[model samples]
Target: MKFNWEGVMPAVTTKFTKDDKLDLKMFQTNIKAQVDAGVHGIVLGGTLGEASTLLESEKRQLTKSTLEVVEGKIPVLMNIAEQSTKGAIYAAQQAQQDGASGLMILPPMRYKSGDRETVTYFKEVAKNTDLPIMIYNNPVDYKIEVTLDMFDEMLECKNIQAVKESTRDTTNITRIINKFGTRLKIMTGVDTIALESLLMGADGWVAGLVCAFPAETVAIYELQKAGRIKEAIEIYRWFLPLLELDINPKLVQNIKLAEVYTNIGTENVRAPRLPLFGDERKNVIQIIESSLKTRPTLPAYKNL
Candidate 1:
């Protein structure tokens, strides 16, 4: 089915066993929880899912698990992002076969040089798959940015249908909306800037923080769409600090910790991506505790 690339798309975490293996049951449970919380979509195998640490077979398992739970209630956007275009294409093909609704493609991370290489990388991947793709422009993690000029060039590819703008620059978002708004759907990936992006004409939000707090995130988007900017901002302020935590390199650890705190998912993550410890671990726990204390209660998961 063709899916609308709008509203809250959670960059979901891949839950793991204490032994660090993929825990399919936990993963599916999390997906169902998000759907129950009313998220518009689910992004499997994204940065937040620690895709780098997962094996090819594990990725397939995750795709299958997510599809089983989602069951077409909402769109399922698979993150087919890897260090090589070949791997990305392979993953995209696998996701499509497994019933993914669309693809969220990131630039090749290994080669971090010229714009020419980046442009070529996207072109090759787009050629390999028929799925509508959302360009994942996150410079901080990938060490490369899809500049405005490169964005324009990639738009020529028919399947390059959308962009998840994580640059945190309102001007860039504004520029893209002003220029290519007709050609592409621009969704803000950064949770903190989601309100600003929507106000400035972004189509939706693909957020990492939404995994831990789906109801709150959905509420924020619904409020904005209802023309309730003041109400949205109030909710945005309550979520800003927790959203900031999602951008940190230690996001996987922090998010899992929050999940544990909320009793939503396991805190286990695969290595060499270790869980936060010592003072850092303590601080994250405190943050989740504090946020829960002040966060507004959702009727569906009131105990959380």
Candidate 2:
């Protein structure tokens, strides 16, 4: 279960029952779909996974349960979005103990640290855990940019291996590669621009919409890796509208609704986040349904 930090790794949604309990059965079902579709890895408790709402025990349960379903077929990486350095370090240690293959960690949540502080927070967490880490450099949403200079400092930590590049600027992929070379791997965290990122030499995609469209998502990555550019674009163009859902504010709810239509998951979310409603719900459904009407038949490609 060594994490290569490459390929389509879903920022999978957390399934919930009617009473807002962990619906592990449904969670496993989605995991199986991802595995069967030939994904390279699985990322748990991410933004799309509703990481903010999950309890510590629930996160541990998710890691264990995802490992059970993947059965070591692919690496399962738990996300760490804690508000404190100590909390982040403890979460990282807990994930390793829970048998997670790796971790996708963010800079300190709820507090925007400077470049030096951000690097320190990540380095501290990296030192405390043996697990390989994919640093989530999502300044667009989180407001703390992990600049290339910060990364230069963080390279001291061997475990700080990969980056979940969500800056929305595709050129940053090339910038990271230029600055760090192979020392740090880059995975596209934004769904809409994933193919562009890959074409620019990103190692993998930490996807969100893949939770509902596993096969299509995997197809895009595999096709790209195989140098089937035309084929990959055909699928990506069809997938663009659906993939845009991941960038919205209610991404969790947006993706969950897509899951409901796709029959892979339910629309149940925790309190403070409800299912999509009114015109918003109608518009999203229109997009999902429209895409489903003409979903493309994927061309055969080797599962890399």
Candidate 3:
């Protein structure tokens, strides 16, 4: 599968059974729903996917399972959040060997690296893999900004093709475009501002909330692309509250709860991250339930 580096690619959650095992069956079901809803691609093992908690073997298993489900219709990308250049390179190579279409590689985790070190890390990983890479430029949470100047350094690596623009500034989208032109595909990484980012000329969205509401997420992107701004805005306004859930520290729990309500997934997350309980659970459920009640009928977007 060729990586297009565009459109709504869900930073999907890794599903688990009560026993904390990989629930590949439920994973497949949710992925099938994403496919049925016409998503552009599937990204596995990211922040939402609990990449930190997953063992190397588990990540490989998730990648292989995802490839099986998506088949060849859409690309399945693995997220590389390793802390070392060697580990990142190994993870990149493993993803390639396991049949990942591309990679969403973060800068060195745990220990924050400065501009020079960060650029070197990304360049090193790109050198090791033939797969196209999306640099996760999430300075707010990750504490390392992959600046335009850094991108200048990375230009020689042809495989470093995209940026997951999670900087939370919509203007950064335009800045990226102005600086690089089509050299780097800019996919907006924040959920709450996704439509805003798309409207601002972002090439696509690396969405989080799409794990539960795939169709609505895809519809927002398609409608915006189709020039149906009025319709897209209406749906986006409805989706705003739910979209806010993706930014919280407890996002995995929040989104898995949304999935539970949507009947697409369970709330069984990995350990050290338990399912939401008490008022936290209730509050999240309130948002999910409220949104579900007035869930807008998606207009025909396929022909758009």
Error of model 2, residue 57, in angstroms: 0.8
Q: Give one digit per residue, the lDDT tens place, for model 3 in 73-117.
A: 998889999989999999999999999999999999999898999
Say what the RMSD of model 3 is.
1.0
Clashes of each: 0, 0, 0
lDDT winner between 1 and 2, please give it.
2
Collision pairs in model 3: none
Over the stretch 62-101, how does candidate 2's per-residue lDDT look in tens digits? Answer: 9989988888889999999999999999999999999998
Q: Sort the candidates on lDDT, descending order.
A: 3, 2, 1
Question: Per-candidate TM vs. native?
Answer: 0.94, 0.98, 0.98
Screening candidate 2 with a backbone cut-off below 3 angstroms (N, C-alpha, C), the clashing residue pairs are: none
For candidate 1, the lDDT comes to 0.83
lDDT of 2: 0.92
